[model samples]
Target: MSQTPIRRLAAREPEFLSTLDALLAFEAEADGRIDAAVTEILQAVRTTGDAAVVEYTRRFDGLDVQSMVALELPRSELLLALDSLRPEQREALTIAADRVRVYHERQKGESWEFTEADGTRLGQKVTPLDRVGLYVPGGRASYPSSVLMNAIPAKVAGVGELIMVVPTPRGEKNPLVLAAAAITGVDRVFTIGGAQAVAALAYGTQTIPQVDKIVGPGNAYVAEAKRRVFGTVGIDMVAGPSEVLIISDGSGHADWVAMDLFAQAEHDELAQSILLCTDAGFIDAVHDAIDRLLPTMPRRDTIARSLANRGALIHVDSLEQACALANRIAPEHLELALEDAEDWIAHIRHAGAIFVGHWAVEALGDYCAGPNHVLPTMRSARFSSPLGTYDFQKRTSIVHISQAGAQHLGKVASILAHGEGLQAHARSAEMRLKV
Candidate 1:
């Protein structure tokens, strides 16, 4: 038989952990040239503002435009795009948007306060950001789903303004993308992309308002620009490639398992997809299914390369071991295609999203599952969480100490302040004390 593209590993092997580590390693070192370019573009935007933005947009997007006005798309354009969509396409988008909105609504935080015995009120005030920027990848790639996922949460959180930036390479506009903007209630639309678009959003140009935070995905240049401008403006995250790890117990069809892996693989050559199975025969079956099904994929070459590079079919002794190993990997998307999937969720310590049971495919979570598909990648699930309404809001501590409360707290604060050797702090607290 011909060799399968993915590598096989036995968990019982002495070198298993080391092999797994090697497979997961990804380091896209920053190129000096790209860094220099991003830095130059950011500075130009910072200093020159609108003029720099126009020049960069002209050079990069191949758009024959002179001023910011040419680059800005009015609300009417977005509405026209939405109205132009075919019935089926429009229906699908509306359904998906509705689902996403409903899900994020549950994540919205509320302000709360409580009174202490001394009448001091301690609380938190949750407020949405005043403005947010959404950067949708344009030109060669455009994802209308990106708009729904990023915008819905911010809108649900009540962000005052939402600005969208998408590049129209060679003056070609994506109607679907504009349609998404129209439906999502984006306040403004700018047809600019790459580092220049990020810069304009980070530091407001003549027309583009400075957003409090920026969210969405883009190319390497966009990623670098977001990283550079993080402190100046909040950013969602510099995400890594897509990933999915499926654990099976031989109950599900091998072909279904194989297709799930391909879904992640087709995302890019660096995307990772792995299958952990207790039955050796099932692992081999999945491998065969992969070999059989790969050729039919439109992105077959990309999938093959991804599988060859990072994909794996791991043979585990038991479901327990598989669960433990999954925790160690901290995958972005995890599928528990085992019996009583919900019962096993407790064993899972980390994953950006979990798909339960054989019917719960990871692809569903990507599109209409209602959860934000913008998840943390590269083992960051161990520390980070999926993007949600919480990410769009900020909390401020609310403390109101009454005279009675101050009298009781002043002594404590004065003592701690003196111990820290700050006389000013001690005096400040003492002055609040009663004579």
Candidate 2:
């Protein structure tokens, strides 16, 4: 794993612009593949129901699931299995869940009504989703943190029910996942995954009931499936490859920066880990650190491909320029490793989540930290926000008017409706006034 550190002049040079184009091209091609796969999975699940899910699980996940009916794990068995976990692991899960719950509890909204001087009352009513589906990636990587992150928010929002789905590639569910589900009080657990699980969640099968919304992360196929089922049911976002952008000065530690970059890069070959720095010497030191650390890491092959293909070390004239480049990328994770990171935060307009200071690593946010780990990618930070209690809840505006208040406000509404050529609307308001 070799590193390339280049010192180039300021300005949006053609070569630098080409680098951006290359990254965009990579993302587009990846998205296209996901779209195709998701369309097929959605169609199959929509038509065949349980049979389709079972078939896809066998084909894609390499597990011969007997039937979709077998997808739902019995709640009793799930709880027993969780109880079998080590005390330390159970304690850690409980701590993480408590922290996540506490943070999200602070985010809860109330339904309140306010009365106006004219006897008109207006307010907003908050309601939790009837049911929500959470997808946790299975196989070799079992994410207990993901369970706490997704479930705690929905639970805090007072969701009526929560159903969790996870792929059991080896025809056996991970004890850790079940334990996490139990710890977080997940309502139901399913032993299925891939695009088929997404389809089942979107369009209910004989076994898995349709949910009001689907949340959590998955691979390309899962992401595509979410994209396909979006209209039929609500989805959080069409997540893309993981990415992290670090803005560091000469003061940042090279080893920590290298390890942080590798943390994201190891997620997938398409994942990007970039560094924007004002000091060229620090860039070289980090490059050396990456080379030293890559050989010892278990996922070196994945990390290497991600770095060689998509990763970059951008040299900028000043910290302001580095921030400008970061905003343009709109990376999923942004780290400000400068001396005074707090002062530079105002300049950051785009980023799924911003980590300030050297001690605030992105890994903390991924696990025990309060904020959600499920964030928008592919420059989606420009418009979207991280998943939170708000995602699993809905709000409806309330309005009530007394006879006198209606009489006073109706004339203005009638005039506006008539001006817009909506005669029915004008008549309705006029009739209400008369009443």
Candidate number of the best TM-score: 1
- In order, candidate lDDTs are 0.93, 0.85
- Give me the runs in candidate 2 sitting further than 4 Å from their true place: 1-18, 21-26, 30-40, 58-69
**Which regions of candidate 1 are displaced past 4 Å?**
none
TM-score of each: 0.98, 0.92
Poorest stretch of ten by lDDT in candidate 1:
1-10
Candidate 1, position 37, lDDT: 99
Top candidate when judged by lDDT against the true structure = 1
lDDT of 1 by residue, 1-435 (tens): 536668999999999999999998888787999999999999999999989999998898898888999988999999999999999989989999999999999999999999998889999999999999999999769899999999999999999999999999998888889999998999989999999999999999878889999999999999999999999999999999999999998989999999999999999999999999999998888888988998889999999999999999999998999999999999999999997788889999999999999999999888788999999899999999999999999999999998899998899999999999999999998999995
Give the CA lDDT, 0 to 100, for residue 106 in model 2: 86
lDDT of 2: 0.85
Worst 10 residues of 2 by lDDT: 2-11
RMSD of each: 1.0, 2.6
Candidate 2 to truth, TM: 0.92
Task: Write one digit per residue (lDDT tens) for candidate 2, span 1-435.
Answer: 345332223334658866664664444455666777788888888898999888888886787668766667888877887788899877877777888888889888889999998889999999999999999999887888889989999999999989999998867578878888988889988888988888898899888889989999887677777877888889988888889999998788999999999999999888889888888888878888988889999999999888877887777778888888888888899999989999999999999999999999999999877888888888889999988999988999999988888998889999999999999999989998767
- Model 1, total clashes: 0
